[model samples]
Target: MINTILVTDDNVLDNAIIRNYLYKERYNIVSALNGREALELLESRNIDLILLDMVMPVMDGYEFMKVFSKTPFYKEIPIIVTSSLDGVENIEKILEYDVFDYIIKPLDHINRLILVNKIKTAVKHRNLISDLNKATKIIDTLSTTKNI
Candidate 1:
């Protein structure tokens, strides 16, 4: 189960709205004023997903992604960019960063639920792969023992 999420946005109202919505759905949340603060929170807490804003003071989404891509923990952490700029050009720009999805402002209930489910599915798939790798390791050990 996804226990928590990090919602990174400079706008207080946007963060509050999203936070309240998620909270009502029983998801614990942590809000970050900017990408830098988000990074710090991520380091200190176990966050399942990040709803990142494209523009902000301190560090922006692009900068965050650049740093995050290098770290093992951040590499697979699904990021859905939630911004008001959902124009074709803006979407193109964000897609270049390799985010999981692009969500526009005034997030509707249906789309929000879809986003949550997508994260759940990804987490499930990741866990299955991890399990498969573990099983393969065990099988390898057994085969080696038999050969010995």
Candidate 2:
């Protein structure tokens, strides 16, 4: 079960909006004003997913993704990027970081639903993949023993 979600956006209003929406869904919402703050939270929290905003002060989304991906602790945490920028180049840049989904700013009713569902799906997929990896390791160990 996904227990924690980290919301990283420089905009204070945006953080409030995201918190309001996600709080209703009973998720433990952790808010950060910038990527630097978000990184600190990740070091201390078990965040299951991240809602990342593209533009920010101190550290932007792109830079954050670059740094975050290099670490094994929270590298696989699913990220759904929230951006006001809409362009092919911007999207391509985000895609390079392996984000699970990209949501444009000013999320409406439909977009909210979609975002919620996407978070649920991403968490589920991560859990499934973890289980598969553990099973594979067990199988490999058993096979080695059988050959002995």
Candidate 3:
């Protein structure tokens, strides 16, 4: 299945660059200008992943993550922070949101490869978790039947 990715960034050029990089992967790309828009999209779309920018107007990445984390339905969606902010402190701050990974902005060919690889890894992880949940449910049902 083709995964849908939400790209939230105030910079139009940055969004375009990311779109270009992911185009080859055939992701159903959805763009949002800020956190508010991203939240709105999330309400209506089954987004598989998110590419977020740290500094944005209306709502920044941290603010978005705060709300996203609190929402149980959104907690499973893996987020990859794509930001210009780079430092041990900054990375730690973003990591606190339970993001899948963080990538420095101004992406190039090498970074694009890195981003694609990370996306693949995250997708695999999500699929594994889903399968495990399904297996657990089946086991629970089997146990209940055996007890009857």
Candidate 4:
């Protein structure tokens, strides 16, 4: 299960609600008022999952994702895009980003739980894969040294 979360949104009420819910659920929560703030915090913190907002005053989600993609570390962090815009056009807009999940605004509690669980499962799988990769690399190095 993911212990930490990064929530990025410009709406104070939205942020508070999400924070309160996650807090009640006993999950660690970190928040950013806008994409720019989120990015700065992201640079310093290794969070388990991201809940991103699409529209903001400075540095929207799409732009943030574009810049985030350039950083190798950000690639592995799963992002769940949250936006008030649920129309086909908006969904289509963010589809290219390959976000782990999408949540429409007025964030439903059950839907939020679903997203949380999905992130937990994904994070667990990621850890397993990372461990396996490390083991494989070690084995390969040992085999090569033995043959030398």
Candidate 5:
């Protein structure tokens, strides 16, 4: 279960819209105006996934990804890019970070549902990978113990 979600966007209205759609689902929602604030929140909170916007003041999404990817906690949380920018260069830059998925802005009803589905899938995928890593660690430990 994805218990906590971070919504990072410079647009206040856009953040509100996302909150409205997700409120019924009852997940703990955390908001940040930009990547710098998001990073501050992540330092103290447990975030299952992030709904990130590409354009923002202070720190953009690409800068966030670069910093996030270097952290030890990167693998535990998944990020879904929800941005208004459609430029080819923007997409290519975001792709380099290997985000869970990229979602364009102006989400209609169908697109909203699609976004929710994608979030669910990404959360499940992150959890599965985490579990696999734990199992691999256990196996490695056992192998080392047997050798000793």
Candidate 6:
């Protein structure tokens, strides 16, 4: 199945590059200019992962994560932070939001490969969690029916 990825970055060029790379991998790309727009997209899109940029005009990554984490349904979606901020403090701050991975940009070929690998890993983990949830629900229903 093609997973939908939400790329949230203020830089149009960054978004274009990421979309171009992921397109080759057959993943559906959804671009957002800022965290607010990303939140709006999340309301309608079935996003499997988020590629977030820390600095943006409106509602930066930190603010986005604060709002997003409060959302129970969305909290499970894996987020990979892509930012130019390489400071350890910056990374630690973002990590507090529980992102799946943090990647520093400009995405060179090696960084792109890392991004793709991380995406693949996150998608697999999400799928496994989904399958487990389904199994647990089925078991619960069977147990309920047996009791009845």
Best by lDDT: 6
Output candidate 1 Cα RMSD: 3.0
Clashing pairs in 1: none
Clashes of each: 0, 0, 0, 0, 0, 0
Candidate 1 stretches with Cα past 4 Å from truth are 108-148
lDDT of 3 by residue, 26-126 (tens): 88899999999999999999888999999999999999999999999887789999999999999998998889999997788899889889988887776
What overall lDDT goes with each candidate model?
0.80, 0.88, 0.90, 0.82, 0.88, 0.93
Q: Where does candidate 1 have its weakest 10-residue lDDT segment?
A: 118-127
Q: 13, model 5: CA deviation in Å?
A: 1.7
How would you encode candidate 5's per-residue C-alpha lDDT over 1-148 as one tens digit per residue? 6478899999998898887777767777999999999999999898888999989999999899889999987667889999988899988988888888989997778878888888778777877887899999999999999999
Best by TM-score: 6
TM-score of each model, paired residue for residue: 0.77, 0.87, 0.92, 0.83, 0.88, 0.96
Q: Give the Cα-based TM-score of candidate 5 against the true structure.
A: 0.88
Which residue pairs clash within candidate 4?
none
Per-residue CA lDDT of model 2 for 6-66, tens digit only, reads 9999888888888888888888999998899999999999888899998999999998999
Whole-model alpha-carbon lDDT for candidate 3: 0.90
Give the TM-score (vs. native) of candidate 4. Answer: 0.83
Local accuracy of candidate 1 as per-residue lDDT tens digits, 1-148: 6558799999998888788877876777999989899989998998777889888999988888888878875765778888878789888878987787777776678767776676566556555656787999999999999999
**What TM-score would you give candidate 1 relative to the actual structure?**
0.77
